[model samples]
Target: MNIGIIGGGAIGLLCASYLSQHHDITVLTRRKEQAEEIRTSGLKRTVKGETFRASVKARAGITGVFDLLIVTVKYHHLQEVLDGLSTLPRQRILFLQNGMAHLLDLENWDTSHSIYIGVVEHGAMKVSDHAVNHTGIGVIKWGAFHPEDTAAVRNALNETPAQFQMIYTDEWKKVLEEKLLVNVCINPLTALLHVKNGELIANPAYEYMMKCAFEEALSILGLAEKERLWSHVVSICKKTAANQSSMLQDIVKGRETERKAIVGYLLKKAQAQEITAPHLTFFNRSLEVLEKKQTKSFE
Candidate 1:
């Protein structure tokens, strides 16, 4: 498969490095310097402590048609990607964003392309534009929002590497909802408290708040099995104990977080369902205020 990965962030570089082993990969970055650097130096990837390079092509914009175009950009920057490819045919664009909110935006797109949504479980951090740290290896669960997209996805996953495992399911809504549960619960609290993944579990007060957020979101989404998913969330925290949540990274790096897409999406749903999400509501507001203050200080 000829894969074109958009964005030059950690997830984008990590996916390109691993998938490039089997597929012909080209990375689409937004900057000329990054593209040139990759072209000159190849992509440097650090897994555990070992550093290696992946031979891949890098471009500043979309060029020719590809077998698969993997979008690994942040939720806030998604519109830039959509606008960049406004003239292209959307046959096999795989979005690997963090939140469920982008689905609503995708519905408004005036294209008949097959769209696939993926919930990434792996832990990755950007060491540089051309380097990524693969902190924790986890499964990538993906499914198509439309029925027309399924066959192509299966073909792409036919000989996928064991370490880069991909699971396909018909119940994509359930899959995304489960991920959204974790995002809404874990992201804001970690970002606000400026703590690592395990701190929420290690600290009693934070753990209680996480539980409240989880129960409220699960109830709102109408998922009957709460205990199982709660355990799953704890397992994730333990698994990625040393890793920083994506939101916290954004805050620390002075970039905008995806509170609107993650927590904001849930709040909108809660309103529609006439369900009160006070804990989520408070955290969302607090994060927004903090983000504003941070942005101002940086400016």
Candidate 2:
């Protein structure tokens, strides 16, 4: 398949590097400098302390359409990118992201296109223009984002590289809900506290607080009745204990974290249902303050 990956951040470049072995890859980005740097050299994928450069077509703009267009931008940036790619390939479009799909209204995107929501545990960060630091490798769960085109997505992923075989059921909502619970628990707390995730484990107070946040999200998702939600949230935090989530990374870079997309979205849902979201409300307020302060600093 000719794959056009939107957004050349860590995830985008890494996916381009890996999937290129099987499919023809073209990395699209609006960031001209990053795109130029990658085209001049290549992608340096550093995983497990070793690295290699994988050469692929890197460009700033994507014209016409592709057989597959995998959108991987941050949640907040999706709308703009989608609008830019208004003519995005109608077939084999995959959404490999982390967090919830609260960007509702995409169902009208394309009735013929197979929209697949994939969750990646692949830990990667852009160290330089052409370098990506992959902290860990894990499974990717994908499934039909639409009700009827399920088989199309299934077969497309079935023939993908074995590494991407981590593709599983398209129970996208459940997968997203599961990830949202974990993100609520760890992301904001880590970003606000300015600590690596691993450090949070040793602090019992923060650990409990994180657990509380997770429970808050679960309650909002009706997962409070499920015992597995609790265990899953705790386990992911412990597993990625030492890592700094994208939320924290954004803070370090003086950029706005995905506070609105993650916690704010949950709070909105609870508000619509007339349910209390005290913790979420508190976190959103605090993060908003931090964002404002950070913005003023930049100004």
Candidate 3:
């Protein structure tokens, strides 16, 4: 299958590096400079201290038809990607964003793409313009927004490399809900506290706050009855104990975080459901303040 991966970020580059071995891949970078660098040096990836470059087509603009279009951009940039692909065929579009916020955008898409959403548990970091480090290996859950997308999703999974495993499921909402629970609880707290993933569970005060924030979010989303949700959050912290949450990495790097898509989306849902989520609301505001500061500094 021919694949066009958008964003060229950590997840994008990681996926391109692995998938390029079996499929023809084209990576779309946000800047001409990065694209040019990839074209000249190829896309590099490091796993377990071993590194190699994969030769793949790299470009700055979206063009031509593809068997699959994997969108690995942040949630805030989803619309820009969609707009750029407006003229192309949307047969098999895969979105690998962080939060459930992009579901609304997908719902409103007036295209013929067999839309699929992937919840990535793998931990990866972009080391440079053309390189990425795969920190932790995890399974990717594939969920289709529509029934017609199952076959495409299965084929994509069938082509998965040995190092990565893909599971196809019909419970997309539950999958996303689980992922959102973790992101809303862990990502913001780590970003705000400027702590590592383990600190959230290891420190008593931070653990208290983590539970408080998570319970409030679960209650608002009516997932309080699901016992597994809390355990899932703790498990993620334990599994990726030494690593920084993506939001914390972004904040530390002075880059924009995905606060709006995760916490901001929950706030809207809480308002619509008439649930008061003070903890989430507080963190959401705090994250916005940090984002604004980062933007001002960049300016």
Clashes of 1: 0
Once fitted onto the true fold, the runs of candidate 3 whose alpha carbons sit more than 4 angstroms away are: 294-299
Candidate 1 segments whose C-alpha is farther than 4 A from its true place: 294-299
Question: Residue 20 of model 2: what lDDT?
Answer: 78
For residues 210-281, could you state the per-residue lDDT of candidate 3 as single tens digits? 898898878767775557778888999998899999999998998889998899888889999998988898
Q: Write model 2 residue lDDT over 140-231, tens digit each, in one string.
A: 78776666646544565566655445476757677778778878888899988999887666799888878778767877888754677677
- Tell me the whole-model lDDT of each prediction, alpha carbons only: 0.86, 0.77, 0.86
Q: Rank the candidates by TM-score, best first.
A: 3, 1, 2
Per-model RMSD to reference: 2.1, 2.5, 2.2
Worst 10 residues of 1 by lDDT: 290-299
Better-scoring candidate (lDDT), 1 or 2: 1
- lDDT winner between candidates 2 and 3: 3
Query: Candidate 1: which pairs clash?
Result: none
Which tens-of-lDDT digit does each residue in 1-299 have in candidate 1?
88899999989998888898789999999999999988888888887799978989998986667888889998899988887767677668889888788998899987766788888888889988789988888877888777763776577766566667778877777888888888887899999999999999999999999999998888788897778999989988887788899899988998899998899988999999999999999999889887877554643
Task: Give the 10-residue window scoring lowest on summed lDDT in candidate 2.
Answer: 102-111
Candidate 2 residue 56 Cα shift, in angstroms, is 0.8
Model 3: how far residue 102 lies from native, Å? 0.4
- What local lDDT score does residue 166 receive in model 1, on the 0 to 100 scale? 77
